[model samples]
Target: MIPLVDLQTQYKSIQPAIDAAALRVLASGEYLGGPDVSAFEQGFAEYCNVGHAIAVNSGSSALHLSLLGAKVGPGDEVITSPFGFVATTAAICATGARPVFVDIDPLTFNLDPAGLADAITPKTKAIMPVHLYGLMADMDPIMSIARQANIAVIEDACQAHGALYKGKRAGSIGLSGSFSFNPGKNLSAVGRGGMVVTNDDEQAQFLRRLRDWGQDGRYNHVHQGFGYCMDTMQAAILNVKLRHLEHWTELRRAHARRLTCQLKNSAVTTPPEPHCCRHVYQVYAVRSASRDLLRAAIATRGVDSGVHYPRPVHLQQAYAGLGYMEGDFPEAERAAAEMLSLPISPELTDSQIDYIAAAVWSDAWRPRAATANLGVKSTRDLARPAQEQSEQAA
Candidate 1:
């Protein structure tokens, strides 16, 4: 079966380099906040074309630290998309700031810039726009709006590691941006890892301090902070993978292009690639009126599919106190019901993509009754993470 992301295949392709890096880190006896982390941070900063990149334990930490560095607090509110992963809202809430929900652009599935003005209030201190899937958000207008309002803009760029918007890298386009290096991401680390990039020197300093127990010096604490530093081993692994990012990104783009071309006439709606942005295709999701049935049909053909999120943040039980109800954000609610992610990775072969597309096409045209009669159990029913699916495939 084709898995959403093939991390095992990626690991095998760079086994020698990975082994050497791991061995070097293990033998050095210097782990936390060591030379390896510094080197990786430098490389990452250069890659994002930003002045600083602070390595953190996970992307969620990166967002929380960014919000803290921006001075967002309990009385403030941060405007953000309702359609994205819960982490975006979680990070804002962690800063003791309320996350103001905004609708998404149906075409790009990213936060709608037009909604920003309406959501801003005197208490709105920042706007966090998520570059969903792999496409960068339309930052030109969003930045303009933020500047006019004198509020900060933090990009939630976890799914768009190497994406570009109007030629600027995703992480460098705003006041600060966060990325996830989870094993299934475009630039996966050995394990959980993340980074925050920014051009502001003061903000960078704040982020550094916030990630390390607010230490001004050895055993001297200045402010309350939590442990969030990236481990030496994770940094080394990511540094090695960073060099091959462009090549792998191109491969993902090529696969997405082919898939879109082949499925253009099918019932599924292909994800859009805006002209002013470069989409890295982290997850090639499609929309269908009959998504559930289509996914079951695809599964019958031995192809695995996934739903990036079956529910939007506003509708989640955890956020019930937010007072959001159905139809509060129409587009996001619609997308939550229909979006289905197909297998997309640099390791995917042409034949595999073709087969997956054909399966989708065949199932999309079938009658609902016909599809139901196939008797194939939906992969979604099993609900395994991409990493788990990769291991099972192996």
Candidate 2:
């Protein structure tokens, strides 16, 4: 079957460099926060065009540190998108701050800047906008609003390593940004890792302290903190991968363009890449009236597909006490039911992309009337009547 992401292919392509890096780290005997970690932090900071980058153990840790570094705490509020990974909101809650959610723009699948003003009140301390699916959120208006409200903007750029908005990188536009180096990400590490990037020197220093047990020096603990330090092994692996990131990102973009061209006229709605923004296509997601049925059909054809999220963050049972009910955010809820991601990793070949596109087209063109409400009744239920008629004739 065509896999959703082919990490083996990527690994094979860089096996020699990866092995050398690992062996060097093993020989060094310094496993935690070493020269490798410091070098990677500097390289990544330069890549993001920021003044500093603090390496951390995980993206969730990066977010938590950023909030604390910005002084966001109890009795404060942070605004974010409802249509995102729960980590975005969970990080806010971890900071002892309330997560105030807003709907998304149907086209970009990012936070709607128009709703920011209404969500802001005296308690609003920060706005955390997630760059979902490797597309940068509408930052121009978001920055304008945040500036007027005097609130910090923390960009959740976990999925967007090289994405650009109006020529600026995703992590550089906000006060501080968070990133993930999970194995499947564009610039991935062999194991878990994350980073926080910012131009503010004070915030950068605070993040450094927060990640290292609040240490101002080797044995001095200046403030309360957590153990969020990055592993030297992961940092070494990521630094090698970072050199090839731009080349891999271009390959992903090329695959997305080809799929879009091939599936343009089909019933599936191909994702959009606006003119002013550069989308890295981390996930090539499409929308359909019968998303679940189509996904099953594609899988049966030896193609793999997935749902980025089957439920919005606000609708999750974990956040029931947040007072959000069904239909509170219609656009996000609608997207949850309709979105499905296809294989668009840099490792996929041209023929593989074509095969996946054909599978999607074959399943997408089934009569709209038959597939429209399949959520309430399945495809098997719709076909049962015809089987009964044939049996009766016999």
Candidate 3:
């Protein structure tokens, strides 16, 4: 069976150097904030074209620490899209800020810059725009709106490791950005890890102290902060993977293009690129009215499939206090019901993608234009969170 992301193949291809890096870290006396982590931070910052990079335990930590560093706190409101991984909004809420959600642009499946400006208000403190499915958000307009409103823009670049926007890096375009190196991510580490990058020294210092339990040094606590430091082992693994990130990203893009061509007969709605942005295709999701049936059909062929998010955050039960109704964010609700992700990993073979496409074609699935305004209720509307929804429904 073709996997969603074959990390084993990636590890095998680069085992020599990866093994060496791991051995070096293991032999070294320092395990956490050592040379390996420092090198990775510098390399990642340079890759993003940013001034500083602070590694953390997870992507959620990266977002939380970045928000706290930017001074987003209780009573503040963060404007973000409802059409992303739930972690994006949850990180904002973890800081005690209310998350105000906007709908995504159907074409890019990213936060619509138009809706971003409209969501701004006196209570708004920052904008958390997710680079969904490895595509950068429309950063120019988002930055413009943020600058005028005096709101910080923090990018959720978890899926977009090397994506670019108008010659600038995806995570580098905003005031600050965060990335994940979960084994499932395009930039997989040996284990869970993430980074926050910024050009501002003050913000960088704040994150440093925050990730280390408010300590300027190791033990002396200065202010209240979270212990969210990334480990050295993951850093070593990331350093090895970073060298081949660009090549892997391009391979994912190539596989996505192959699938697009094979499935372009309108049986499903394949994504289209924005004018100047390139999608790295971390997940090649297609919209089908009968996505579940098609997914089952593909599974019969032993092909793996997934739904990046079957539910939007606004519809989540934990945030139901936000008072959003079913039709509140039409685009996001529509995406919840229609989108299904197939295999588009860098390690996937062309024949595997062809087989997946052939399976879809045989299933007789067709695009449903009526999905444009199909406002499904929040998955959490019944006072149950998505995790519970999944558990109970299953």
Instruction: List the candidates' TM-scores in order.
Output: 0.92, 0.93, 0.91
lDDT of each: 0.87, 0.87, 0.83
Q: What is the lDDT of residue 352 in candidate 1?
A: 100
Candidate 1 weakest lDDT stretch, 10 residues: 371-380
Superposition error at 298 for model 2 (Å): 0.6
lDDT of 2 by residue, 1-394 (tens): 9999899999999999999999999999999998999999999998998999999999999989888887899999999999988998999999899999988877677888878899999999999999999998988889999999999999999999999988999789988999999877888887789999999998898889878889999879998989999999999999999999999999998888788878876777777766567788888898886788788889889999889889999999998888999998877887798889999899999999999989987844463533232233111111325554344223
lDDT of 1: 0.87
How well does model 2 score by local distance difference test?
A: 0.87
Question: Which ranges in model 3 have alpha carbons more than 4 Å from their true place?
Answer: 364-394
- In order of lDDT, best first, we have 1, 2, 3
Q: Which is the winner by lDDT between candidate 1 and candidate 3?
A: 1
C-alpha RMSD of each candidate structure in angstroms: 7.8, 9.4, 8.2
Give the TM-score comparing model 2 with the true structure, all chains together.
0.93
User: How many angstroms is residue 150 displaced in model 2 relative to the true structure, after the best TM-score fit?
Assistant: 0.5
Q: Which residue pairs overlap in candidate 1's backbone?
A: none
How many residue pairs clash in all the candidates, one count each?
Answer: 0, 0, 0
Tens-digit lDDT string for candidate 3 (1-394): 8787788898999999999988888888678888888999999999999999999999989989889988999999999999888888889889999999988886677888877767899999999999999888888888999999998999999988888887788788777999998988989887889999999998899889989999988688987988798999999889889999899887887787778777766467775555366678888888876777778877887888899688888888877888888889987887888888988888888788888888877834443452342343321112335564344223
